[model samples]
Target: MLREVVTTRYVTPLREGGSLPAIVEADDLGMYVVKFRGAGQGHKALIAELVSGELGRGLGLAVPELVTVQLDEAIAKGEPDQEIQELLLASVGRNLGMDYLPGSLGFDPVAFPVDSEQAGRIVWFDALIGNVDRSWRNPNLLRWHGRLYLIDHGATLIFQHNWPRDAGALEKSARKAVNLEDHVLARFAPDLRAADAQLAPMVTSEAVDAATALIPDEWLVGEPGFDSPDDVRRAFRDWFAARVRAPRSDWLPELAR
Candidate 1:
């Protein structure tokens, strides 16, 4: 389980994200950017954040530390904005919190030239997870302390949203062409073949199981067609394992032309 922290105060709302995440102070004396469970995206978004974020970290990517933030309904009483108050009240139990990067800058592909190897790895990783949000228009990446950090994985692993309807969709989706022409790193990703060779073997069943284990049981509960949280975990692990072992470069964006 991720470490749990009690929110001491809600500092301010970050209006940039559609989900309305906020900057909050916690009992641990650390500030976090909290993603509310009350958001329209629901608990599945939080599950994606944990699974994808941990996978990225395991693959040697820089990702923010995550925690389960405990929210109290009383915190909503002090908010003047009715919308924010409603959101807080609805998310009075557990929310997702990411370690706040104070001086980080949004990544701009034009201004920063990334090396081919790193770019290939990033593109490959995003492709493996079926991430559609890392395009140039809304690159969910940050440049902090001279390193790039991945964030906002709530949008990845989209197959989960409809898993109850189509449990077999993951395999089909994994083999489809990735629309990476608009990916922020597309132009810089010169050698995906090399990236696949280097990164694929690292995603073992043990690694996938360990990463999936970090997801909260509450988030896994109520998943359709699953008897328990462990069942859901196994489903995710199996999907990820299949993708890693049988990477379809045919699905990769045609950037080499």
Candidate 2:
């Protein structure tokens, strides 16, 4: 869990990020880049981002540390989540985690510190859940301390239920199919780890319940989190175990188990 403010003040926004993520200081906690969720997707993307970033780090990848912090309306824009916005405003501070990727450079293939081999590791994870956020133009990767780390996954694993039924011509597909380049498919192609399977269980009934507690009640007034975190967990499980693993890929099954 994280708070809104601490001993230090929010210096300013990190101008480099397209998503407009801000950089703030915490006397005891250090620096963090916080991103707010808005109209296009939802706050669930932020949750997914936290989960994926944390899980990747757990897998021994050089991902930045994750933290949660609340964003003020002055810095937050385009967020249609009145409930979350109000929540962020109310409790002085909320649990918006941060992933410290200091000295890390933004997305760039040629300048990337990672070898072509490890590229597949990330691609494999993205493909499993249709993460299209990390792309050539905006690869959400950074190089820090000579290690390549991923970030800003607030665009992956979009919930199908969120898609608008009347969003005519805007109907989107589920997080089942992902587009990967030939080289990416070549590397981890042979052994795409069960990133989804390994990550899904941690987002369990109990975990969701706990997370729901952190989220403001207004945001969860009738949300699946407040009513039944298990429902949200089940949505993730149904997607991962059913479609994400529908393919007979070894990595999928290995993770599924």
Candidate 3:
């Protein structure tokens, strides 16, 4: 389970993406970028953030520490921004929080070049999770202290959104070809095959289980076709295990040499 912290104050709103996550101070005296369950993308987005973010960290990628933040309704009472206040009021409960990276700069391809191996691994990871948000136009990446950190995984594992329509969607998504032409790292990802060889074997069932274990029960509740949160966790683990064990070299997009 993720460490839980209570929000001490609502500092400011981060209006970067559609979700409008905010900078908040926690009782632990740590600052975090809080992703509210009340956001437009909802709880499923938070689930994706937890699952994919942890999985990336397990793969040796840089990911900020994550925690569950408890928000009190009283925090919204003094907010003058009507929209922000409404968002805060609606999110008065458990929310998702990422340790804030101060002085981090948004990734820029020209300004900061990435090595081929790292690029390939990042692309492969994104493909495995069916992430569609890491494009050049809005690369959800940050550079801090000369290391790249993955962030904003709320748009990943999109097949979960289709559960109400088709429970088999995850299988199809896992097998689908990833279009990487617009991926922020695609231009520098020289060896997708090599990346598969190096990273695929690392995604074991135990690793998958550890990552899925971080998801909160509240976020897993009310999921369609699942009797309990454990059931939902099982489904997620199964999907990820299949994706990792199955050969996905064919699913990788061709990268320019």
lDDT of 2 by residue, 1-257 (tens): 42444414455656565545556666566887666554234456566666566545545566666655654455333335565444334333444546566666765665543443465456656664466766665777677777777777666666544632332312223323554553222333334444444544443444434433444333333563235544554444444444432443422322111
lDDT of all the models against the reference? 0.85, 0.51, 0.86
Q: What is the C-alpha RMSD of each candidate to the true structure, in Å?
A: 1.8, 7.4, 1.8
Q: Tell me how far candidate 2 lies from the true structure as C-alpha RMSD in angstroms.
A: 7.4
lDDT of 2: 0.51
TM-score of 1: 0.94
Task: List pairs with backbone clashes in candidate 1.
Answer: none
Which segments of model 3 are wrong by more than 4 Å? Answer: 164-170
Candidate 2 least-lDDT 10 residues: 248-257
> By the TM-score metric, which is better: model 2 or model 3?
3
Please identify which of the two predictions, 1 or 2, would achieve the higher lDDT against the true structure.
1
Q: TM-score of each candidate?
A: 0.94, 0.65, 0.94
For residue 122, model 3's alpha carbon misses the true position, in angstroms, by 0.4
In Å, residue 170's CA in model 3 sits off its true spot by: 5.3
Name the regions of candidate 1 deviating beyond 4 angstroms.
Answer: 164-170
